[model samples]
Target: MVIDTATTSGDTALKQKVSSLMSTLKSDLCDLVRIRSTAGGATTEAANKVVSLLKEAGVSDATTVKIGSGRAPLVHGTVTGRTGKPTVLLYAHYDVQPAGSWNETEAFTPTEVNGRLRGRGAADDKSGIMMHVGALRAFDKNPPVNLEILIEGEEESGTGSLEEYLAKPENKDRFKADAYVVADTGGIAVGRPALTATLRGIAQADVTVRTLDAPVHSGMYGGPAPDAFMALTRILATLHDDKGDVAVEGLLSKPWTGADHPDETTYRQNAGVRCGVPLIGTGSVAQRLYFKPSINVTGLDGAPPPVHKSLNALQSEATARVSIRLVPGQKPADAVAALRRHIDQHRPWFLPVEVTYAGGGEGFEARTGSTTFAKAQAALQEAYGQAPTTLGQGGSIPLVNLLQARKPDAPVLLWGCEEPAARIHAPGESVHLDELERMTLAQALFLKALSQQ
Candidate 1:
């Protein structure tokens, strides 16, 4: 961690400037993979061609960083390093995730299977924004840190203008930084090399159940009716207790001392786990999927208990959709008010229960003593040669907890470029090519070791 960036004063011209920027990154990754930019608001014409590819990678101040309404247009850009040095922000996002079944042709075409490179935000982040524009055009774009390529088009629909484009107090002293380069993650296998400190924060709740008012009469009041689908299956069987964990009441748990997963028959073929199902409650799947706090009842809309709706007799309702995964200093609206006081004091029989509220994001444990996480773990052990294993991504980058709740000691780092089997939004999502050239040399030797830290 020592840099002083004069773009590292030429030395064999930085390996011929990363080989002429990998031939202009295969034509700028096929022109941002022909843009579909997925998820609603299509992301302003691929965020205006990534703000004209960050003003043609020179970034003498790029643009498009709008707020709220625009959906996905946080392309801001900047340059300036030499004089004094120290600076490196680089975050990534160009709005994606949402491109299924293309019957004819157009998930934004640009295929190229064998050499690996598809569409829908190719590898969950335009291949980490074309490896930060091929390591800033192999230094020709003058990268050695002191850059701030903060892209975003709503990180797949959550980082919407990421906390209003990093709450503008003049971008907190021009996004002051010493580290941060999420070239998207992956590498527990292939060449194996990962370094994702931690990220877990989220809590959502949605439970509904009512008895009497409309459709009823299962065999003329099937045994003294009043059945909102067996009272939402006995309130989802009292929210799991007898060993299945999660009994709600004040949600939060601990004991997942950082990264150590994959062991349940490789998690039944990486989460397919069917035969004699039992990969649920145990220890370490990154400790119940990234450091504790998980209770998913997903969804359960009413009426239709396996066919038999005897017209209108009265009413009977039932609905469930609870989602929780908060961890970093838990407070997703107080774990959604303790799952609404454990489903209003578990009175499923007396009926009348309605607790609704969904939307939460605040979980990240990233603070393993910094210095840019130890030079991003020696640039992921020199770009995937080995040693680099640290995990905890129970998925929740709600704008990195809104930029760590407005720079709570800013130094956020999360990996990207698709991994959990790159099925990102599903269907042959793809992204491998030597783990995208070892994540473009671990984001170009972590921006030349944070521009000479």
Candidate 2:
């Protein structure tokens, strides 16, 4: 769809303005990345920094507000536009994941290599914050639509307080909007614009298996005694079939009908799959990733490192943290129950097994076919020179569901700068400069289009 000549000219000018502010955007993003705002870490500092940036970008009322006890601060602000104009809430997270041993550079130390900025939060979400800031700055702080900025601090930590805050009757007016721009998700690939239409929910549990009262000597009891570690592994092995499909019953799944995923070669490269390692599961890649339930043993706490602390003893107890990703139709609680039932039915050797609920959140499926979504697609197409496509993320963003619940009428637009190569939540995380620029421009154009509507 071709934008009118006048709109195209304005978009050209806005694009130039966004280009001019790229340096500032990069600087602000790098500074934000330097904060170690992991789930329970320096999120307050990151939120405050975002508040300061928002104010500098013309959100004069921007300030950090506490949501709940033990939860990170939330940054809130608004830019009032012309009377009768539709409101748009800009959303992104300031918190980041902990830096594991995978980063090429210090997770807190932002580095610019080639055309990418490398840091922990640089891609996952810190860039999302900067994208909103850049788009507002492009409009010189006076956007065409009424703008509300909600930069979250605990999104990576399960968004505990925001849920309660939004549920209050008095807070409804604060978030009333015609559209919600959730900049926490990303495109399908660099320079390929895409909107995330669905997100998988998460259900996790800590399963403990106790085989004996205490550790026993391997040589003395190896023949007759059951090992807790072995029993735990056996229980986990039942989660998948021979083809790697989830073996758990009662979990909901359906075929994906969105844009096709990247070819196997590209997907393997993007996912950093080891050479010769086959991609597991059946059906289309998109279906496996976005429409089906998958289980993973995220952490184990029974066996010592064999290479460093090998012991000639059998463990008495073993515990594993299992994470299950759920599709849109499934409830988190129901999924957890199904998982428990599966483990109970598959326990080996009658070992004593206990399951403890970890945390979980429901998935989201955006309401498409709205005027706001259409404008967003047009804006992306204009910015990238290609039509935008729809995609679904396997990861969970709890706040998306909460915000949707609060404002069911508002169309939620999920797009960002973290493409496949950005490596979000993994080592060597980075965001392409071009992707950031295009997204910022697209956001600015989208808001302008909304104002005209």
Candidate 3:
């Protein structure tokens, strides 16, 4: 998988320039990860820092755009390229998921260990921020293709602020590009680059069940008491059949036709499944995970935390947060409606069931046959020294759908510096240094290839 950059002297030179900036890359990555940019935290600070870094990295027109005073502003800037060259918009996010606790170091404090950087936003997106910066710096600020930076400040929260910003008529021309590179997705494995071809959408609800007016003593009404928790559990049990496939009516499932899905053993290890524990669901792990609807009880309220002890009475009411991930071509609203209908049909013991519809976003399916996609394939292969794989992400990237809707002609490529071992959104989140560097090279090569067209 030697990169076919021999015919392009500038592209070959860009690779060397990126390699020379390894130390600077790590420094910038660690600095970006150290900012506490969680959804509820000071994301404005992170956004401002990204703007400043972009300016320092050669983007002379870097600036922050804020819709409101309290909202985290988006960072937008550009590096002018040769006349008549195509413009490439690089997209990433600064906001990170909530970090519960840390293992080796504090969530906000980036720690480097054995070629990995560990922190809250280190891999999920802070590394994404640096990956773009490294790529732009490789071209000395002005890439072969005109470069546009649109680092969103609130993507994880799914507020769609950036989408709204881009929708405005005045802002449309400012951010318009021939191609979009979303650096928020990860490779299949470290050093194994992958272009995400699809993303699954999510729908959620807080379901409650009430069976009694008040708590009853277990000793007096142990068998006869209509416990709300028991009834709620029964209703949830109907979500999955004996084969572990989702049993909800009207939901959709399809076979995955791209990329190499993770093997059962790798999936188990990544999920930390206990020894001898059978994997749930039917079909291949990728099919069940990426191409089928899945239900999960994310949170249960009014339950004892196991550290506390109170087991004498039957509770009168119970609530659980149910999250459902919908595959591509499945509408989020339809899935939500189907789930509500399923709950209605499976009310245990005719108990009162209440379902509240939370918000959800639409999934994305990429077109792999486009010209920009071909350039991306070549760029990724050149950067990784191996052919890249095409895969679909099970997580939702709502903005991808918005981008497609607004600019259907522009192809979107999803690639980034994280891998499964990064543990994004969980404890011990980290980024592989090599993946970050290679992604930087890939973006540089991608821009050069697109420019030649």
Candidate 4:
């Protein structure tokens, strides 16, 4: 990654301006993080807060658009630029994942420690919102290119509200742009700059197993009666072979040709892998994560807590939510079908089994050969003192595919401040201050370069 030193005087001034706004950025980010805007929770306050911030940043038309009667609101706004300059659509999500039991810090309370902001959504997406806000403020909300801001409130939920809204013919023209910047992804490390060039899609299913009509005493049926919980465990065990790779047939995968993943020690530290537990699967970390199908039992029910709530009985039924991450070129429907078939074939004791489809979306591969991509690389190089590397994200953003399909020619850039250490969707989520500042400057520089083109 070679560093470029061809920054113009204006670029230098912009960098200085962004630096001066760091305190404000941190303050604003903390304010946003203070709001408990978890998906399906009350998010109207968060939406209004974003609209107010955008308006204060010089986007006077910023407001929240209701998606449906009960769905979360979408924050939309635009800043007009000089005629002949291209339009750039900026995207980020304000909704956050639920804070589970693992958080070291309070999930909604914003805390700053060692130059990082700690809270739920601080790095996953709320920081993404701040990235756009800080950049627009650096330019006094008048960017070099025409700007269309569409901040979603249901990205973490995977409800497809934004996708359905954008699909409408009446609303298509408002989102059309020469370039799109999705600020929901991030680099590989704290100082390393990366643009997510590909993203794995998601497919999910609910698997239920039934053996008997009702529970029976374990003392009487322990040896012969089929236990639905035990049966469910056996069925789930078949999802992965001995090597821990997905055993489902007809799913697609390919060799990873992008930037290499972190080494084992760093990867373990980032993932918080328990010590002495060997990593499952074959091939390199990037290959396993970016270019292959993986399955996880995300939820399970019908079994009581083993410690105090356990019953010594043969359970009649059990159910689990299975989540599958599909590689590029794999259809969500096909993956779900394959998963259902695999579940049916693996049922033990000729038990009754059911598999039902859940929601999912297709993966995305960016058009990285475009001039906009080059500008993004140069901008990141200028911001981080090294040329950016392209990487693939293991997560899915269904909206990215919709945008790409809507405007096939426009390049969609995915970059953000959330590095591996951020622990997004987990406890102790945080965003490094320096990474936030650099990402903001990079976005500002990319917009300036696009205006020049």
lDDT tens per residue, model 3, 231-315: 8889899999998989999988878877657889888998899999999888888888788888999889755336466677887
Off by over 4 Å in 4: 1-5, 102-105, 168-174
Question: Candidate 4, residues 1-453: lDDT per residue as tens digits?
Answer: 333349899999999999999999999899998888887675888999999999999889999998854378999999885799998889999999888885534898898899889999899898899899988988976787888899989988878888887778887765888899999888889889999999999998889987888999999888788888999999999999999888999888899988777667878899899999999988889889899999998888887467777788898889999999999878888998998887778778777899988888888999988888988999999999987789998989888888876678999999999899899998899999999999999999998999888
Pull out the clashing pairs in model 2. Answer: none
Per-candidate TM-score against the hidden true structure: 0.35, 0.95, 0.92, 0.96
TM-score: the better of candidates 2 and 4: 4
Instruction: List the candidates ranked by TM-score, beginning with the highest.
Output: 4, 2, 3, 1
Q: After best superposition, candidate 4 residue 73: deviation in angstroms?
A: 0.8
Q: Between prediction 2 and prediction 3, which has the larger lDDT?
A: 2
lDDT for 411 (candidate 2)? 92
lDDT of each: 0.69, 0.87, 0.83, 0.88
- lDDT of each residue in 1-453, candidate 1, tens digit only: 441222334433544555556656756766776676766745788888888887777886788866766656678788875676766678777777666574214555657677666666677778788778777766667776577778877766554456654666766655656555566656555566676767677766678877777675567777677778677777778877876767787877778875576556765775566888776565667787777777787667874644464454434776777788877778788998988888778876666787777777778777757776777766666555566777777777766655555556767777755666665665556666557656665666676766665
- Model 2, 1-453: lDDT tens digits are 433323567888998999999999999989998999987788888888999999998999999888767468889999885799998899998988889886534878998998999999898898899989999899998888888889888877775688778867888766877889999888888889998899999988999998878998999998699988998989989999999999999889988898777667878988889998999999888889999999998889986457777888988999999999999978888998998898889889877799998878888899877878888988898889888888899898877877776678889989999899899888888999899999999999999998888
